[model samples]
Target chain A: MTGVLLPLLSFFFAASIVSLGWADMLIIVIYFLLVLGIGYYLMHFTKTGDDFFLAGRKMTMWIAGLAFISANLGSLELMGWAASAYQYGILATHWYWIGAIPAMLFLGIIMMPFYYISKTHSVPGYLKLRYGESSRMLAAISFALMTVLMSGVNMFAMALVMKVVIGWDINVSIWVSSITVMVYVVLGGLLSAIFNEVLQFMLIWFGALLVPIIGLVEVGGWSGMVAKIHQNFPAGDYTHLWSTLGHFKDNPMGIQWIGIVFGLGFVVSFGYWTTDFLVVQRVLSAKDLRSAKMAPIIGSAFKMMVPFIVILPGLLGLAVMPGLVGQNQAAMTGAQSYNEILPLMMARYLGPGLLGLGVTALIAGFMSGMAGNVTAFSTVWTYDIYKPLHLAATKREVADAHYVKVGRWATFIGVVISIGTAYLVQSAASIMDYVQALFSFFIAPLFGTVILGMLWKRATASGGFWGLLAGTASSIGMWIWVRIDPSALRIIAGSPDAKAMAEDMYRGLWSWVICVVVTIIVSYSTQPKAEAELVGLVRGCTDLPSEGHLPLVKRPIFWAGLILVAFIILQIIFW
Target chain B: MADEKLKSDSRATDSPERISIWFFIGAVLLVYGIIILIASIPGVSSPEGAQHVMLADLHAGIWWGALLIVLGAVYVAIFRPGRKKD
Candidate 1:
């Protein structure tokens, strides 16, 4: 262990020695100032809760699409996936493709119209419209709490990156990021967050593009990377996507393709990409129903390419970086302790100016993620929680500006709470474990409930409430059972892997099954609202607006179809 | 009662004049240009006196900066505000 520690320490020391120059610092400062300026400039536009929370529903398809993906392009999506790529190899691309693409496209085609036509400010608001107060309150409170915790996770991740890369004190890193995020979010609300996210999206691509480009250049090209990876790690099948993924024992992921297909691709990915309010809020802010429908489709196109930016870096780390793939590193830190793969690559490949831009991209990713969470949290808290409670007590209608004021306060309070949560997460041995657990508890179950309510007119409000409760409870129970008796997971999850991610995927699948079953059983027993009452809320009952006289090629369906084709082509090529 | 409140609250706000997508694209180019240009300047150093290297040998910051500036100029010119009036 000490042998591993010594080398790891030496590696970190060597990487940290490459400090930022004056130009780098200047560029970072300019980036921050520009972000703040955007917030201040947009403040005039944010007059009411409508504008504050949903950008006055005036976002174009391009803005909505970029922001949709950008909101998810946080520290975790960047660093965690890169780390996964390094650890799990090309199999990590599944999270972007089979895991995300289908769900996002489904959302654009099947779900966005209801959300747009219903005109709800948040996901919880949608629930209240379709179900009742019970379901809405449960979802709102849980979602609000989860967003803050997720934001803290981003904060902790950014601080960890700074400590590893530049050797900054974690506390200073946390404070600087928290303050910067709080300023923009509080000043301009969702619009500011989305605008900055669009900018960060561009920066992430430009900055991280160098790694794969330069790394591929160094290794010759695509074929060269595969050959080098094969030579370096003879025991690992790093290149094959679906062919070698037949059984748990067949691949490094240590799970069957069925589990990957059903658990991650169907349950967890659909849960997150389709229902998670963080990305949904971006689409909900679109100028028109058409733009809202187009947003996720456009986002799916970009999301498909994300593996190159995130996963490719990890593959490069394995092929290039020495002492990263040995038994000691894997034993001490699962997956070769390649969490710092991204920063290490940046330190090595980027000269001076580009280096600053790369680091700024990291910062931008962290802040954008933090901002996404806080803005989403504030919207939910103010609209779904505080305002509803206030109305219940006062029995009066408050002005839209009153809600806007509450949103600002919520943003401030949310950031402070997130800062506290970030410190709390410091005690955890693994941040990824905690986050994945949170997702299983909240996201998967919520997806089950939302999908049922959206698709079926017969689903009762009481059913939605009880179904959500049962799903969450089952997920927790399964997690505890797995913890106490490691063997128990094998019954449901098929063969268990040593990796937590595989377990998480299986847990999500089981929880979703429980939720759906309970919802159906309870719904049949209870009285459902009449079809007349459920008109716009349920599919088949509602008449979806026609795609405005636009040509076939210009319509969202055409683009979505093209994306689906591209997805299949890539899968086949990678396979 | 709740439905009524939702209806009242969700009234569509007036549609503002369309802001051309080019504006955002131009703004991004301008920011990237400035950063690249500043970083490409010579004699920039760390506090420890380590010199910074240029990103590329072809005066990358200068050329990219100039090109982006021109592109931004063209975009802003073509899609300038109040073009609908014309």
Candidate 2:
């Protein structure tokens, strides 16, 4: 009874807020239909575990490229990204430009060389061949855990953002949206994921692109925003860039550039670009070896500009409501909560007609990310863990053969778990932060072990096995320290208007250090494994594409050029 | 297929072809370096940085779209798809 009536009731409420009932309902219904219809259509393309997991390894670099971009786009980006940029100050801005851009190129030029040569369906399965079974299983389990937890975070975020905008029950938003996203995602697996992502990317890019342009025109002009920013902030507040980083009572901006650029950025950049199943699967699904390698770079180049779509609006929103945003401690924490900034801004500002599109843009972003997450989870589980442990069919795991049906079921289960988790995740932190904090527990450890396994052949099975355990435990401990520490948690929980620099440092710096230190120490203490077995997995003869890998000579040339070019560009910006 | 192979960035004629890979990588690196340099500057700000952050904000469409076209060109060149024996 509630299921049918609630969304309808919510639809009317949504319609009434903007005062255009039928048109908005029609747009939402049509968009939902289009997603389901296309998802079902893409499902027809799946034939085997590889087909389900890797889209039969026949995706064009362009489609795969678009899908790769879509994997990063989620409903949360509009609000979450803008909110973070609005609150976190400038250095946090490095993630998209410096981090994502380089990370993509690295994956294309380096990781692709190995993936193409090895022809492994799963990223972790390659680890098994390169390191041992222990590394493979450990990576696989960690990936599943990360995906499930991340999905919950995504669901909670999607529901919360919509609830704030439409005044709907969070429960109604979760199941309705999750079930809809799951239907198409499960029906086709990566095929559906790629298909939906292509559409989602197109819409999200358009939707986000529309916001600042519309918001700017509607409010006043570009200079008008600057005037407003000054009006809202104290005289000196709107004038300083790096001042936000230094302005913390407890320093909510986080530990300086080292933590922001390298520690936090490097760890996350590598984890998502290299090891994450979602983005890797898109690259893996590329039509040929060259396309797979090139896909990430293509996607990344596009991502450099996402800050405009995502982060700028929050900053601009402050310009709209100068007196309301508050300054000093509240303002800095507002910057830290980052994800809440976008939706609240959108709800508070924007005209009715544009509001529909803003909401639509947010929906597209959510679907794109959710589609990426569930698809990756399905592929890693069905291909790596499930088939190896329970099923004994070699023919089923091949590039094109026997496991489509089961793979779809695995995707469905992943979606269900995601919905359950989403409902459980609280609205305390912005969706991205809550998800990131949880995901870092799983991902940070995996990042440490993978770097060791890839760079050092002597990294033993027992070493990787225990290294993963130690990394995860340490990350969780660091998170607890930040929370339970009388200083940080009190500030995070809003009990006191706190001022502690070390407390902010815990949020940004400590987790990555803990993971890297623990992983290296544990891996170093273990014995070496047989190098001969890892040969075909990381370096093989058969499928090696002549063109894809970054040539040895090319590296130094690029590094030097990068330094020179960066020098000139900065000279212009600064001088 | 022959034309595709001939024009392909990696399709160098033996050692000369392999050497150009270095050249291509160098060009790409130059783009990245430009970005880093922009950030490394002493007083350059961001979107919400003291200045209203509008230069990159307002013109992102022009730059990212134009950059996308340039990247798209690289992709289209790679995607031309050659015959196996060519």
Candidate 3:
């Protein structure tokens, strides 16, 4: 949710930016009907808890792969990153390339086998297997709370975007979108969510691709774009990716190389891609081990192409619409906010039919994001929190049918809670800033604990729990410290010129470091679990399945290597 | 017991009656492509119909709409559910 709204919190629009025609309204209405139709069609197949939670563990590689990438391709990401590109130039592409591709490939090649073989339903379930009940409980409660709150954040953000973009009423946007998402999700669960995500993925590409295509044509081409930007800001460097990163003040983003490399590329990116259950749940639905292993590789291939639609449009805005102001100045001077670039570009280029398609695509992005969060929230709430608590209190195992019923109820309840959160956010806008900050506290430390438990046989359960606790506490402490004293940003980010984004990266790095250090120290002091009990859960004790007998073209490692080569080539081309 | 049940549930997903997700994608795209293609015809006849966007002469709606139609048709043909052999 923070990922969707973090860059957009400053936006405050006084009037509608664009008006939609009948063609646009028709396209959006068609999208709503199709999603609900999918849910109603799939309802018959959603008979058991497994089907509702994990898509019956039966998705093909292409389906799961597309859904995995699409789940993260929310409207906030599209608009927010486009704004970032306008604000920071081509440096924003780093968030897509170095920040995402490596982490996704790492998840596919290094981390997937354990997750696939263990048959864990969620990330917290994996923790339960490796770190005991207490660790699982801690991870599950925090994750469940965070996921629902984030859903609410996405909901409110979508409503706000609608009210600003086409003058839709905020209450109408909130209720209509919320009810549509709730009906589909409650009817079909994860399968419905995954299916809609795939559809949303296609819609986003088709609807938004024209903006860059038209923008590039107007500016001439790539060289023409570079020249126009150069003409616009002669003293600043916007076209080059790596040349201006020698110092904090040298770059438009005020970020240094170390923060980009370690803080974002290594810590924050890995933490989100490798461990976030909203995305990982999609991969877990793959039919077999090989499919699971290949899914993220497929996702990364598509992920590399996303910057063409997202980042290029922002850079194009910088070239074509050079006088856009920051949100603060926009409110005072009545100039366009940088956040309005995507819709502005859409309105500038798209005609009647195409304009409708673009609007539908934005709506699809928002709903897909909402469905992803709600589905993941319901699964975690049911499996990790509710089922365990019910078992402990009643001392009996529930029937599969009963659990499936409970899951449906959880789905409905989760959506209601999310709608409530959206209204709360509407009443108090500053809640978004606090919620976004609170989200960063868990991810880095959770990654540290999970990765340690998976790889190191010596990591004790006590170490995992205590390390996670300490890391989270310290992250919150650091956020408060920086909040109370603005000068503390320099200490945290390692430079006086460091900006807000740099502070985030550096804080993630420090929290992760604290987690790893505390885990090792505590593990050495505690008694280790028996080696016999570690089979199938840790690296050395488990025998990995062989794929060497297959042809070279069929191996996951081959595709991963190909993706790595593509990633490096992109870096060189942009450099 | 729960694990065993989950393993068994995987078989249910392969039921012959289950519809392919691709077919829905293809169907939606085909409908959208047809509508846009028809809509672009008026634009081609009168410049006023194009809404005065950049590159109005290129008739992007015609090309883009035709491309979606062809792609959507192919996906529908290949992945249509209820076919016995799939």
lDDT of all predictions: 0.80, 0.60, 0.86
For candidate 3, write residues B30-79 as lDDT tens digits: 88888778777788889776655777788888888888899788768755
Looking at model 1, residue A560 earns an lDDT score of 91
Over the stretch A1-575, how does candidate 1's per-residue lDDT look in tens digits?
A: 43454444334333463476555665566778878887887777788888899987877777789899999998667888888788888999999999999999999999999888988888889899999998999999989988898788778867877876777678888997798889988888898898889888877887778778778877878888888888888998988889878777778888778778999899999999888899999999998888899999989999999999999998887788745643356566665357778887777666556677788888888888888899999999998999889999999998888999999999999999888878878887476466647755978889999999999998999899999999999999988898898888677677655355578888899899999999999999999998887777789789998887889976999989999999999989998
Off by over 4 Å in 3: A1-15, B1-14
Residue pairs in clash, model 3:
A24-A356
Show where candidate 1 strays beyond 4 Å.
A1-17, A325-336, A427-432, A496-498, B1-25, B34-86
Clashes of each: 0, 16, 1
- Against the hidden reference, what TM-scores do the models get? 0.90, 0.73, 0.95
True contacts kept of each: 0.17, 0.00, 0.37
Model 1, chain B: what is the TM-score? 0.55
How good is model 3 by TM-score? 0.95
lDDT of 2 by residue, A354-421 (tens): 33445666787788888888888877887678778754555443433445666778778888888777
Candidate No. with top DockQ: 3
Stretches > 4 Å off in candidate 2: A1-21, A89-92, A217-224, A235-254, A325-354, A391-402, A426-436, A487-527, A536-575, B1-86
Worst 10 contiguous positions by lDDT, candidate 2 chain A: A15-24
Instruction: Provide a comma-separated list of chain B TM-scores, one per candidate.
Output: 0.55, 0.30, 0.77
- What's the distance in Å from true for residue B30, model 3? 0.3
